[model samples]
Target: MPTLQRVPALVASGQLAIPVAEALVALPADVLGRVQAASIDPDLADTAAFSEAYGFPVEGGANCIVVAGRRGEDVRYAACIVLAHTRLDVNRVVKKLLDVRKASFAPKDEAVALTGMEYGGITPIGLPSSWPVYADARVQDAPEVVIGAGLRGAKLFLPGAVLAGLPHVQVVEGLATPTPDA
Candidate 1:
C-alpha cells in the first residue's frame, strides 16, 4: 500500500478530476468513507511504474479501459476494469457481451474527451450513467485495489467489495485472461 497521505476522496477535489470529485461527493456516506485518494507523481501514474515506485504490487492495481462496440450505425461504449497483471478479453467476452460484431479499445482522444479525464487516468467512477462498467470477478477477491483517480497525479484506493457494488458496475466472470508472462 502507498505510504502517501490518504484522505476521503470526496474532499480531495484538487487532486482529482472534477467529475471524479463530484462523483465521490454524490456517493452515500458509507460508500464514500470506503474510498480514499492519494497523490502521486504524474510521471509515474501508469500502473507498472506506479506500482514499482510506490511498493504496491502490480496485481493490486485495477486498470479502467474504455471500449467501443459497433453494430451497424450504432456504437456503444463501456468501461472494463481488469487487474493490471491480466489482459482484458475485449475481442471475445466484450464483443459477446455488447452483442456487436466488433469491440475494441476506444481511441485515446475520444475516451479522454468523453470521460473528461486524462488519457492515462480514466477511472470508472465518473463515467456516463449510460455506460456499463464491466468489472472482472477477480477484482472482488482482493481486500483493496488501486485505480486511477481520473487524473494522472493521483489515485484512488478502495475495498474490492466496494468497487463491485458501485453503480452501473457488473461483475463478470472470465472478463479477462492472465497475460502470458505476467
Candidate 2:
C-alpha cells in the first residue's frame, strides 16, 4: 500500500465533511485510531485519478455507491462498498437484499442531498443511521484501503476489517464481481 502523509481523521476537521468529522469523533478509540485522513487535490478524488496520481493501487481503493430500491410506493436506500476494480452486483444481490422489485444507482443529486456530502466523496461513514451499508466480502480482506473522506479534497485510509466493523455495515459475499480486464 502507498504510504500517505496522514493524521487521525477526527483531527483533520478541515479536510472532512461536518458529519464525517463528527462521526470519527464518536467512533471507539480502537477503531478511530486506525482511521487516518490525507489531503488531495479535489480534481484527483476519483479512484482512477487518485490511484494513478498518488501511486496507490487501484484495487486498494474502495468506492461507495448509493443505491435506491423501490417497491410500490416505498423506497429504500443503501450504501454499497466495492473495490475500485469490481462492479457492484446491484441487479442481483442488492435488489434481493433490499427486498425491492427494482434497484439502481441513486441519482447523483439525490445521493448528495441525502448524504450531505459531495457527489464524488460520499463515504459509508456518517451516512443516515437508517441506511444499511453493504460491503463486498473482498473489502474485508484488504490490509488497508483508501476511501472517500466525505469531501473531494481528502481521502481516508483504514484497515478493511475496520470498515466492516462500522455500525450498519454488513459484509456480503459476492456483493461485487471483478470487472473484465480490470
Candidate 3:
C-alpha cells in the first residue's frame, strides 16, 4: 500500500478527470488508502507500451473499456475492466447483461466526452452515474493491478479488490477471455 506522498494524492491532482478526485475520496480508506497514482509519459499511456517501458508486468495491468448497448429505443452504457492479457466478452456476455440486441465499444471521442477522461485514460472511477462497471473476476482476484488515472500522463496502482469494492461495480465471472498471442 502506498501513502499519499509516494504518488500524488488523488484529491490533489488537477490532472484527473472531473469528479474522479471526489469519487476516489468517497471510497473507504481501506480501498482508497492503498492507491498510488503516479505521473507517466503521456506517450506511454497504452498498457502494453507502459508496461514494456516501465518494467511493469503484463499481469499487473488492467484495461478499462466503455461500451454502449442498444435495446430497441433504449441505449445503455457500461464500463468493463479486465486484465490486459484478456479480451473483453463484449458481444456475448455484455450484450446479454445489458439486455440489448447489440453491443459495441463506445466511440473513442464519445467515451472521452461522456466520461470526462482522456482517450487512453478513461477509468471506471468517475464514470457517469448511469453507467455500471463490470470487473472481470480475475481482476479482483489479483493482488494488485495498474490502471489509468483518468489522465494520459498518470497511472493508478492499487489492490484489485479496491476496484471491485467500488460502488456500482460488479465482479463478473468470464467477463473476459484469455487473449491469443499474435
Query: Which of the numbered candidates is closest to the native, going by highest lDDT?
Result: 2
lDDT of 2 by residue, 1-27 (tens): 334689988779788998898888889
Q: What would you estimate as the lDDT of candidate 3?
A: 0.84
- The predicted structure with the larger lDDT, 1 or 2, is 2
Off by over 4 Å in 1: 1-3
- Model 3 regions more than 4 Å off: 1-8
The digit string of per-residue lDDT tens for model 1 on 1-182 reads 54678898877889999889888888999999999999998989999999988998898999999999999999999999999989999999999989999999999999999999998889999898889999999898878999999999999999888998897799999999999998
Better of 1 and 3 by TM-score: 1
Q: lDDT for every model? A: 0.92, 0.93, 0.84
Q: Please provide TM-scores, in order, for all candidate models, with all chains considered together.
A: 0.97, 0.97, 0.92
RMSD per candidate (Å) reads: 1.4, 1.8, 3.1
Q: Native-vs-model 2 lDDT?
A: 0.93
TM-score of structure candidate 3:
0.92
Which ten residues in a row are the worst by lDDT in model 3? 1-10
